[model samples]
Every structure is written in C-alpha cells, then in structure tokens.
Target: MNKAKKMLFSYSFLAPSIILTAVLGLYPIAWAMRYMFYDYKGYGQEKFIGFDNFRQIAEDGLFWDSVKTTFIYAGGKVLVSLPLALLLAVVLNRGLRGRNVLRAIYFMPTIISSAVMAVVFFTIFNSYNGILNQFLMKYHLISKSIDWLGPDHALFTVIIVAVWGAVGNYMLLFLAGLQNIPDDIYESASLDGAGKVQQFWYITIPMLGPVLQIIIMLAIINALKGYESIMVMTGGGPVGKTEVMYLYVYKLFFPTAADAGGAVQQIGYGSAVGFVTALIVGAVTMVYFFFSRRMSRTF
Candidate 1:
C-alpha cells in the first residue's frame, strides 16, 4: 500500500472505538451538561431554569448528608485497605511457598461482579438469620445478634465490604511496584546491617514512591466513585445511612419504590448532582496531587 493509503488503513482501525466513545461516553456527558441547568422531568418539556438546580443542590440536606457519608466510606476504605494491601504485597513478595496461588486467591474478589459480591455479603450480613449472626450465636461471641446492615452500622458495613473488594486490586498494584525494585539495593542495605523493617522504610518505600502515589490516587478515586455494591446491598440503606455521593445521584435519577413511599425520577436535578459529584472527585484528586508533591519534596 502507498504511504497515504497505509495511514488511512491504520486510522480505520481506530474508527469504531472513536465512534463508540463519542456516542456512549462523550454524548452522555454533553447531554448531562446541558440538562444540569434545566428543570426537565423525564417526560416533560426541556425547561432551562438556569442555576436553580445548583441552588436546589446547595439547599438539599440529603445530598450534603450523602456527601458526608461518601467521605466517611471512602476514608475508611482507603485507610484500611491501602495499608493492608501494602502489607500483603510485601509479605507475598518474599520467597514464600504458594505465593502465586495466594495472589490469585486474593485477587479473585476483584473479578467478581459487584452485584454478585453484594448479594453474597447481604446473605452474610442480613440483620436477621444471616450466616454471620448464626455463626456468632453458635460461638457465643455476643449476647445478641449484631445488625450489620442496620442504619446504625450500615455505613461501616459498606466500608468493610468495599475494603474487602478493593484490597486485592491494590495488593496487585503494590506487588508490581515491589517487583520493580532491584534486589541489589536491599542486599547492600543488608550488608550494612539494615534489618528488613529498616530496608522497607528507607529503600523499598523510596523506590516505590512514584507507583505508590499513583496507586493511592486510584484508590481514592475508586473509593469515591464506587457505589454499585452499596446500591445492591442496601439501596443506599435503611435510612440513607450508607448513601454516598454517587449512590445518591443514582437514586435521584432512578428513585425506586423503596424511596419515600414510591419516588419519581428527577433527571434535571440528578444531572446537576452528577456534575457536582464529578467536581468533588476532581477537587479531591487535585488535593492529593498537591500533598503528594510536598511529600515527594519532603522525602
């Protein structure tokens, strides 16, 4: 083929992906952007009410409550899972038997469907007649069955489930970063009588700094954006206790029979909420980047 023809052929290979992205991803975002300022229900005229939707959002106590719950859930998941994942990666990076098998076992959850995972956890954590309650009763661990999915504990329970699903993915990331570090650095440190903990703190951590930052950023984003499992498990909960930002946005767009004695959708308001939620996630990412820069300079 001639050079121009060859170039055209190469571009043709990317045509489908470009078209699909424009249709599915780009189009929806553009639509939402246009709708955020309007006051259109699903089956009405496209009324452009300007910043009224944003104003409504500011006054929406439930939306702000959802934001608070989101931060709590995201904070709990990242704080608990990242350290656990790092510890697991460090141990498994050693010359342990069946480490590969163990890695696969840990990563299995990442591949599971969020809906299926939530269902399984729901069975285990049901307020009454759950497997966990049964086992606890059998072991006499508590005088009464614990309500894992109750309003009081729903947020905490969702955090635990989120951590469980996320740890494996972060562990693999940590493992990859750990593997990239040269063994010679550790060997030289060992020769100088640096113990394993000292080598880890001084050498491994420093070497893995760039990868660690990326992993942390991903974790924060994932924690903030994730709501599928929570949606399925509690549908934003017994009383919005487990409702996060994304889940709240979902409910606003697709309010179900469970909401407020049969709810209706709010497409315009939901679009506004979605846009604000994206901004919140973006703001968080910027803050992390800011701190990471300072941290890199400090070390």
Candidate 2:
C-alpha cells in the first residue's frame, strides 16, 4: 500500500476506540465537571453557583463519616488480603500435587461478578435463616443466630467478602512474580542453611519488592473503591455502618426508596462529592507512590 493509504488504514483502526473512549469515558467526566458548579437535579433546570457545591462538601458530616469508614474498610481489606495472597502464592508456587486445580479453585472467586458474589454471600450470612446460622445452631455453637449483617457487624462482614474476592487476583499476580525469581537463588539459599521461612523472608520478599509495591498500590486503590458488595449486601445500612465513600456518593445520585425524602438526588452535589472522592483516592495513591519511591531508594 502507498504511505498515505497505509497511514489512513492505521488511523481507521484507531478511530473506533478513540470514539468509544470519548463517548463512554471522556464525555461523562466532562459532563460531571460542568455540572459540579451548578445546582441541578437530574430533571431540573441547572443554576450555576460556582464553588457552592464544594463549600457544602466541607460541612457535610455524613460524607466525612463515610470517608472515615472507607479508610477502615480499605485498611482492613488490604491488611487481610495481601498477606494471605502472598502466602497462597508461595504455597501454590511449590511443587505440590494438584497445584493447578488448587490455583483454579482459588481463582474462581475472582471471575465471579462482584454483585453476584455479594448476593451469594448475602444468602450465606443472612442473620436469621442463613446456612451459616443453621450450621452453627445445629452444632450448638451459639445460643442464637448471630446477626452477621447488622449495624455492628455489617462492615466486618463485607470486608470478609471483599477479601475473599480480591485475594485470588493478588495471589495470581504474586504467583507470576514468584515464578520469575530464579530457582538458582533458592538453591543457593538452601545450601547456605536457609529454611523455607528464612528463604521467604530474606530472599523471596526482597526479590519481590518491585512487584509487591505495585500489588499493594493496586490493592489499596481497589479496596478504597470497593463498594459493590457493601451496596448489594447492606444497601449502606441497617444504620449506615457499612457506607463507604463511593456508596455514599451513589446514594446521593440514586437514593433507594427506603431513604428519607431528603436523601433525593442532588446531581450537582453528587458531582462535587464524586470529584472529591476521586481526589481522595488519587491522594492516597500518590502517598503510596511517594513512600514506595523512598523505599525503593533504600534498596
């Protein structure tokens, strides 16, 4: 083909993706940015009131509380999931029988839709009639069924579900990192009198540093953004106990019928909140990057 036709052909291939991204990704963000300075419901005439939406964010205690709850949820999920994922990666990386099947079983949860996974967990953790309750009751483990999804326990319950779904993904990443390490390094460590745990601590961990940094960063962002299971399982409450920032923003734009009339859609305010929430997540990622850079220097 001639140069012009070849160039045209390349541009043609890129055009569809560019158009889709502009429509699906860029347009919504631009729309939200425009509306953030306005006072509008989804159906109302928009009234521009610059910075008012942001000012309101400062005084919104509920949003702040949800931010705090989000930190807790994110922290708990990361703390539990990363170590377990690494451990699973280490174990499964070994030369063991049926390791492929085991890895597949562990990974199955990652393939499930978050909403569908949450629904399954809902059935299992249902306080009154759940299979968990039935099993515990039959064994006389407790005098009565514990409320797994109540206000006090709801956050914890969702974290467990989040970890269960997330660990598999991190494990697979860890497995890939592990496989890239040379077997010769382990053999040398073994000859030098290093035990399995010693090798893991002194060799595997140090070697996995770069990938670990990336994994932890990804895990933190995912945990902070995770709200699907919380929304599905609790709808952000028996008492708003499990309300993360994203879920809170979701309700602002799309309140459930159960919300008080005051909780109706405020598209402008929702946009502002969404912007702030994105900033919060972005700030966190930046902080992690900062620390990771310092740690990388030390190594």
Candidate 3:
C-alpha cells in the first residue's frame, strides 16, 4: 500500500477512540471552561459574568479548606501506603511457600468496589456496637466506644481506608519492578558480603528508579482524586471534616434533596473548582517528576 493509504488505514482504527474522547473527555472540559465564565445551572440560559466564578472560588473559604483537606488526605495516603506497599513487595519477593496466593490475597482489596468497601468499613467503624469498638472493649483497650467518624477522627478514618485500598495495587507494581531485577545482581552483591538490607538500599532501590517514579506519580494523582469512598462513608462529614476537593465539587454541583432548597447549585463555581483542581494536580505531577528526575540523577 502507498504511504498515504497506510496512514489512512492506521488512523481509521483510531478514529472511534478519538471521536469518543473528543465527545466525552475534551468536550466536557471545553464546556466547563465556557461555563466558568457564566452563571447558570447545567442546562438553560447562561449569563456570562466574566471571571466572576474564579473570583468567587478565590474568596470562598470553604473551597480553600477543601483544598487543604485534599492535600492532607493525598499526602497521608501516599506516605503511609507507598512504604507499606514497598515493604510487602520486598517481603513477597523472597522465596516463600504460597507467596503467589498471598500476593493475590493482598491484591484482592484493590479489585473490590470502593463504594462497597466503604460501606463495609462504615459498619465496622460505627460509633455504637461496631465490631472494632466491640473488640477493643472486650480487650479492655478503652472504657467507652470511640466515635470513629466524629469531627476529630473522620479524616484519619478516611486515610486508613484509602491506604488499605491503595497499598495492594502499588505493591503489585513494586513486585513487578522487583521481579525484573536479575537474580545475578543479588548474587554478585551477596558474593561481595552484602547483606539483604544493604542490597535493597544500594541495589534494589537505585535499580527500581524508573518504576518507583511512575508508581509515585500514579499514587499522588490517584490520592488527589479521592472521592467515592469518602462520599459513601462520610458524605463530607461531621462538619465538612472529611470533605476533600472532589467531594466539595460534588456538593456544590449536586446537593442532596434535603439541602436543595438551601443549596445554590453553583454549577459554574463547581466548574471553576474542577478546572483549578485539574491545574493543581497537573502542577503537582510536574513538580513530582522534576524532583524525581533530580533524585534519580543523584542516585
């Protein structure tokens, strides 16, 4: 076939996906950009107010609070989950019976529906008569049942659940990176009288540079986008304590029926928040990669 025909044939296969993306992904974003300059519900007449939505978001303390909450949630998840995942991966990489079965068991949570898991945890973490509290009381750990979803502890609870669901996937990534390392490298290091800990620090980590960078980037982005479980579990809370960025956007755009009368339904403002969040996430990803590259170079 001619070069032009070959190109046409190749692009034909991609046409459906490109069209779907434009319609589903790019179009919504473009529409949101347009909407941010207007005041309107998702449907009906939109009156363009020109940067008013942006100004409103900047002035909204609640929005800023949500931003802080988002950072805290994401940071907590990454810090706690990634290290635990790496540890699990390292342990599983050793020669052990039923290691494959154990790996599957660890990864099972990652495949489960986030909403379902959140609901299950909701029952488990309930203030009165929950299994956790029951067990603790039985063991004489406390005099009273603690409210796990209360204002003081809701964010912490969310972080624990997020980490539990996240560790498995990242652990699998670390395992993949670990498996790719040739056995001969570890043998050579062992011959040099290097211990397992020394091999991991000086050899495994340095060698897993590229994979580690990708895993970190993915974890950060995923953590930043936390929404489903928090929604199902806390609904942004006992006084907005667990209201991360995505949940805040959801509340703005789609208030509950009971709140509908009081809620303004600020779709434009929500769009602005979404757009700004996208920018923030993008910036964070870039910064992470830049520092990651520097660290890789140093190593």
Candidate 4:
C-alpha cells in the first residue's frame, strides 16, 4: 500500500479505541483540571477562582490528616500483603498435588466485587454477633466480644481486609514469575551444595527481580488508589479515623453533613487532591524504575 493509505488504515484501526478513551478517560481528566481552577458546586453557579482552591487545600487540616491516613493505609497494605503473597506463590510453585485448586481458592477473592467482599467482611468483623468474636468467645480466647470495627480497631481491620483482597493477585503474578525461572539454575545451585534457602536467595530471587519490580510497582499503585473497599466497609467512619485520601476526595465532591461542616462542596479542591495524588504515585513509580535500573546494572 502507498504510505498515505497505510497510515489511514492504521488510524482507522485505532480510531475506535482512541475515541472511546478520549470520551471516557481524557474528558473527565480535562473536566477535573478545569474544575480545579473554579469554585464549582454540583450544579448552578461556578466561579473561576484560580489557585484559591489549591491554596485552601494546602491550608486545610483535614487534607493533611487525609494525607497521613493515605500513607498509613498504603504502607500497611504493602507491608502485609506483598510478603504473604510471595510466600504463598513460593509454596504453590512447588510441584504439589492440588496446587491449582489452592491457587483458584486464593484468587477467588480477587474476582469477587469489592463491595461484596466488604459486606462479607463486615459480617465477619461485627462486634457482638459476628463469627470471629463468636469463635473467640467459644474458644475462651476472650471473655468478652471484641469490637473489630470500633475506633481503635477500624484501621487495622481495613488493612487486614485489604491485604486479604490483594494477596491473591500478587500471588498469581509471583507464581508466573517463578515459573519462568530456569530449572537448570536451581539444579546448578543444588550441585554447589546450596540449601533451599541459599538457592532461593542466590538463584530464584535474583532471577525473579524483574517480576518483583513489576509486583512492587503494581502494589504501590493499587495501595495508593485504594478506595472502593474502604468506602464500602467503613465509609471512613468512627470519626474519620479510617479516612484515606481517595475517600477524603470523594467526600469533597459528595459532601455529607458531617464532612467539613457540610460547607465544603468544592470540586476544585477535590481535583487538586486528585492531581497531587497522581503526581505522588507517578513519582513513586519513577523511583521504582530508577532503582530497578540500578539493581539491574549491579546484579
């Protein structure tokens, strides 16, 4: 085909996807950026207020509080989930009977809707009538029922739930990475009188570095973007003790009477928060890539 005709054919093939992405994705991003410079209520009046919204976000105590909460939530999810997922992946990577069934069982949580999982966990973590407390009481582990969703335990509960929901996906990723490792490498390590631990440390882990890098990137991204499960489970409740950045931003756009005196229906402020979050995540990803490159050169 002629150059122009070939170019036109390529563009035709891509047009549908490009159009859909522009409409569904890029349009909202543009809208958010525009709204970020204005005092936009859900309807009616919108005043173009430049950097005032961003300035307010900078000065807002609740915004800072949400930032702290976001870090805690993200950190907790990564710290707890990644190790467990790696361990599970290693265990399943062994040529064990029923490994496929076990893998499916673990991954079931990932396939289920977050809202449904939240509801299931809500019942499990219920204060008095829940199965967890009941089992504890039955075993005489505690004389009284523990409130899993109380102010003191709410954040921990959320973290535990998040980890449980996330581990399966990471496990599958790790398993795929593990499978790609050449058996000859491990066999050579064994010939060198290396134990299982030494083989893992010297051969498996080094071989899996690329996969680990990808896993870390994914974990950080998901941790930062964590919202739906928290929204469904706690609703950033128990006096905002469990409030993370995404939830905080969500409340900004869809304000409740309890959020910021119900006077802060600022779409601009929310968009600014979104922008900041995107930047933070991008920076983190870039750092990961930088480190990965260095590690690749060194190892």
- Please identify which of the two predictions, 2 or 3, would achieve the higher lDDT against the true structure: 2
lDDT, candidate 1, 1-299, per-residue tens: 89999999998999999999999999999999999988877887788899999999999998999999999999999999999999999999999999999999999999999999999999999989999999999989877889999988988899999999999999999999999999898899999999999998999888889889999999999999999999999998788898899988888788888874268778899999999999999999999999999878766
Question: Would you list the C-alpha lDDT of every candidate in the order shown?
Answer: 0.93, 0.93, 0.91, 0.88
Q: Compute the lDDT for candidate 3.
A: 0.91
TM-score of candidate 1 relative to the true fold: 0.96
* Model 2: CA > 4 A from native: 1-7, 260-263
Q: List the residue pairs that clash in candidate 1.
A: none
Give the per-residue lDDT of model 4 (tens digit) for 150-172.
89999999999999999999999
Q: After TM-score superposition, what is the CA distance of residue 230 in candidate 2 from its true location, in Å?
A: 0.8
Lowest summed lDDT across 10 adjacent residues in model 2 is found at: 255-264
For residue 239, model 2's alpha carbon misses the true position, in angstroms, by: 1.1
Clashes, model 2? 0
Model 3: runs farther than 4 Å from truth? 257-261
State the lDDT of candidate 3 residue by residue for 1-299, as single tens digits: 99999999999999999999999999988988888888887678789899988998889887788889999999999999999999999999999999999999999999999999999999999999778999999999999999999999999999999999999999999999999999999999999999999999999999888899999999999999988999999998878888888888888789885432356687887899889988888999999988998988966
**TM-scores for candidates 1 onward, in order:** 0.96, 0.96, 0.96, 0.96
Sorted by lDDT (best first), the order is: 2, 1, 3, 4
Model 2, 1-299: lDDT tens per residue? 99999999999999999999999999999999999999988886899999999999999988998999999999999999999999999999999999999999999999999999999999999998999999999999988989999988888999999999999999999999999999999999999999999998889998999999999999999999999989999988887788899998888889867853465788899999999999999999999999999978765
